[model samples]
Target: MSTVEVLASVDIVALRMAPEAQHLQVLLHRREREPHAGQWALPGVIVNGRTPDTSLEAAAERALREKTQVVPCYMEQVGTEGNAFRDPRGWSLSTYYLALLEPGQVVEGEQLAFFDLDSVLARKVLLPFDHNLLVELARERLAAKTVYSSLPLYLLAEKFTVLDALGAVQACLGQAVNNTSLRKRLERLRERGWVRDTGEKNQPRLGRPQQLYQHTPQGGRAFMFERSLLPEGV
Candidate 1:
């Protein structure tokens, strides 16, 4: 055997709250070309070695911008999957990313459809190129992080109530998070000066006012806790 070429690609799992704010959603678009044409899949792009995309993260950003026009506030590498069978064209590898987004993160016309993660997790929808597995991986990674970190805050508005914070975690985790654990997490953030009470409350039609909290961490870093909110796969 002489040699073979293994191409590289980047896939993104951009997640946010659904339009109705009832569930977590992932961005997907129908493939325009063959090998999986017309099938809805995660936004992805082939890396061009001759270009300025010198890193997988850069290619990931380009894929995100070109496919969804969304610049997320937080994104992380999920993992790499490179095998002769993952793609039809030839041997290839893909480095997938998990992005946490908020409403209004879309800067232009968004052609990507938001699919409820619940549906995907339930196997109601099927994706090609082993993307379903990638989605599963991203889901677990996000849920694990949410258990002990403030990554879910990226899905929340700048100012939110304690309920909002907990809701964000539950939405991302796809499971009810322990309220006491989350409250203590917030308290820890406050102690670390990462978040603070804004001294304001939301005015509702009937319910009493609820205290507000604001994330104050300057950089885009999630404050970590000493323990996990839930055991892995819990």
Candidate 2:
């Protein structure tokens, strides 16, 4: 007669761009209670049936809102992990999500911080309770999505130039995308109304002005295509 595990939680890999789009960052928070209290961890919240989360997403949203006080521009459930040893108190399960914020999205809550994803992934920073593993898994999924979906677009600000979009994708994938292929994809996205050319260009101090673009009314969510900025699966 094993005891039924009561600990079920949702962890969010709330990702965003650093100022100037220098790096991709993930949101973390310091725990307040025992069992890894005071340790920086991915934003998480225990499932409380009384709060009556209408769905798993609702619970994930609550964790992001309550723990970090910021709503991501895009969010998706990545996967789940469960085991007896992950949590010290008892057997527990965690449903983790990948949430993306626009560039320069500010954190408005106390004790919430954003760390460079590279640092976390490289073990320069450590997290508690399988959180480090969760981040690694989420990044893998995010990178795959970046290859074939508009997932990286959520990392941009409301208005961005082609170069800006490339920077975002590069940050997520840790590789440079072809400027030509990216332009082609944007054209396709524009045709589908997922993106709109703002009919404006940003003047740079050094070079030519770059055209600006933004999401259209129907483009609040990430959209997928048969390919990315290249030929199918290139």
Candidate 3:
């Protein structure tokens, strides 16, 4: 009797959050060949070796460089999916990684744009293989993280207003937050000294002048570390 050997593969998915539009965007590359040719799909590479020391992080970095020529600001492992029929060719297990990047960092590819999660979910676009499920999982992870962490900062520019920051958070969660509750959360963040008012007030058309703010270096690191420790499903 001959024994069948299982093959292992690693695939990285980069998720970019845009708060203003309140969307979680995944980078999809257009395929130039058969098996969903001209279709959009996540950037990934196949890993093969006896000792699988190959990290998804490295694969993600390499994919970014090769596809978009950009380095992401944040990366984290989400989970693994292994189904005998997941791949068309053979039995494979794919390890997925999530990444966050600032706007304008990546070179746009054919049909590249940050898409709104709500729109994607509503329209039910056919994703390549099981990639849609992977996206849903990543979206839930990011939305839950943004509430008490500084993950949203990656979506904003160096200097931004409180409203801008709050909008980003709301977008990730796919809903509008109560003004009072949101303000309280911001106050708590301010108390922790994670953010600073930039001292530049912007006068809008029909409202009180709003003060701008920026994330402090100390605050940024603290938020990142705190987020890393958040319990699963947080």
Candidate 4:
């Protein structure tokens, strides 16, 4: 019988804006060495060790910095996956995190590129070591969590207009939201303390300036959505 060896690792699902491509893109890195050389995969790292002060979340953050050099505006652990055949090296337990980066937050790396969601999901691009599973899990988690939580705020700029907030949410959902329903939802969110007025204004190229708002630091904990604002399959 083969001996079962366990290893711990972190896989980051990093999302960023790609305006030129006209869609939100996920960051993927091409491997240079063995096991999956020359193939694209999610940026990740092995957990070398743990200390009294270091935790799994900390390990994930460090791995992200060491590999991708991008510090996300917001990050949270979504789930953990372990399968006997998932890793050829051995049995591996991978902690998955969903991370969001603003437009200018990432510095382009040689081995990294922001890929459109469709391209990544189409399976035409090669990925190994269950990396694609991590991406799919992250996508579903983000969409589901955003339905009931204020998690989409992480994708927005420091201060944003209502349209900007809607756009961010729409990007994650990959569908257009009902304007009236969204307006009502935002109003309710504000009343529930999920968002607050920033006392600032955003001047568009043509339209009159609109008031701006920022997410409350602790807003995500304040409420749970009664119904999903997104489409059924999202």
Candidate 5:
């Protein structure tokens, strides 16, 4: 009987706000070693007996810090993949985690690069080891969860303008969001105590001064969306 070796690993899908690109970007690192050398891939770590007491979350944290020197403020388990052919070395199982990092917080190295959602979806860049599929799944989750949960807050500044909020939502949904509809949603969110006006305004170069808002202490409430809110832009 041929015995297969089973190993466990973790992969992170870190998203960040990219104002310069006017969208969100996913963090990826270039694989320097073999198997998929010179290809962009998600940062991951091998799980072994060395960190016996360390939980999966802790392991992921350690992995991100060690591999990329980036730490996310928000993280949640997405799912797991255990295709026997996934790893060339042996049968490996990877537990995927979705993490969110604020812009200006990440320090990018020569090996690390951020690719915008549109470019990623367009396959303009190369991604190996099923990393592209992982990104798509993570993006879907972000879009679906934003309708209910305040997950997009992680992609915004501490104090943000209405456009900032809307842009974040648009990046997640990958659709053309109606400005008026988004403003109404923000107002409704404030009325529900999910967010609060900060009494500040952002002076834009083109438009008039806009009010700033912040998530309330009891924000990020998870609910359900009754209807499709995003337009078919993509």
Candidate 6:
């Protein structure tokens, strides 16, 4: 009898978002073949060599280029899955990465589209492997990060309105934000000059004119935080 040795492999999973007023839309691709054929899955690729640089992060960049022809604005490893039986072909370990990109920044290939996170949650879409769990974990992390960190900036345009900025944050939290509290948060940001009013007002339908704003050049650095794992076994 011949014994076949199963080798460990690394893969990358990326979650890209499209900012919307009520929810942060996530990008998902329909797999064309097993192990999750015809199911929704995150964009990913396998690492070819055993090196630290040829890691999950590198795989994610390659996947993005192949799938959408664009590099992610920001990406970080979120966690890893090393279940022995996770892949039907062999033993595989996947390192998941979370990426944030602006809407329409990438030209998606076939079988890819932006999906509303709320709709996915409501419909309970069955995802490939443990991806459904991964999405949930990513959502929780994004919500917490948006509260005090600069993660939300990735979703906004280079210049945006205060309402638009707040809307993006609310979408991440998936809840209504108190007007007073939101104002206070903006005030703190303003005092530091991390954000400033652009002195332009947008006249949208059925509302008084609202002023526009933009994050300062230093806002990106100010809002960034060291990426950390979700939790052990999460």
- Which candidate number has the best lDDT? 2
TM-score of 6: 0.79
The prediction achieving the highest TM-score against the true structure is: 2
Q: Give the alpha carbon lDDT tens digit for every residue of 63-141 in model 5.
A: 7887789868678888888876777766778888888887676666789888786677677865776777788888888
TM-score of each: 0.90, 0.93, 0.79, 0.84, 0.86, 0.79
lDDT of 2: 0.86
Model 3, 8: alpha-carbon shift in Å?
4.1
Candidate no. 3 TM-score: 0.79
Cα error of candidate 2 at position 43, Å:
1.0
- What is the lDDT of every predicted structure here? 0.83, 0.86, 0.65, 0.76, 0.77, 0.63
**Model 1: runs farther than 4 Å from truth?**
1-3, 104-110, 231-234
Off by over 4 Å in 2: 217-219, 228-234
Query: What is the per-residue lDDT of model 4 for residues 1-234, given as tens digits with 9 covering 90 to 100?
Result: 146558778888999766533357888887887778888888877775553227888877876777788888778888999977887777788998988887556557688887776677776665788877788889998877777766777777778778777777777777787877777777787897777887889888999998898777562342467887865775
Instruction: Compute the lDDT of residue 211 as modeled in candidate 2.
Output: 91
Candidate RMSDs in Å, in order, are 2.5, 2.1, 4.5, 3.1, 3.0, 5.2
Per-residue lDDT of candidate 2, residues 26-78 (tens digit)? 88999999799999999888886677688889999999878988988888899
Give the range of the ten consecutive residues with the poorest summed lDDT in model 6: 225-234
lDDT tens digits by residue: candidate 3, 1-234:
112655554455565655445466667667666567787766666665743346666766666666556566677778888776766655667777777776554556565544555655554665676777777777787776776677766666667777777676776677666666556655666777877777798888898988877766462342743332223553
**lDDT of each residue in 104-222, candidate 6, tens digit only:** 45554577866677666555666666666666767777777776675665667766766766676777777666666556666666777777878888888888988777766362343
Which of 5 and 6 is the better model by lDDT?
5
What lDDT score is found at residue 124 in candidate 4?
64
Tell me the lDDT of candidate 1: 0.83
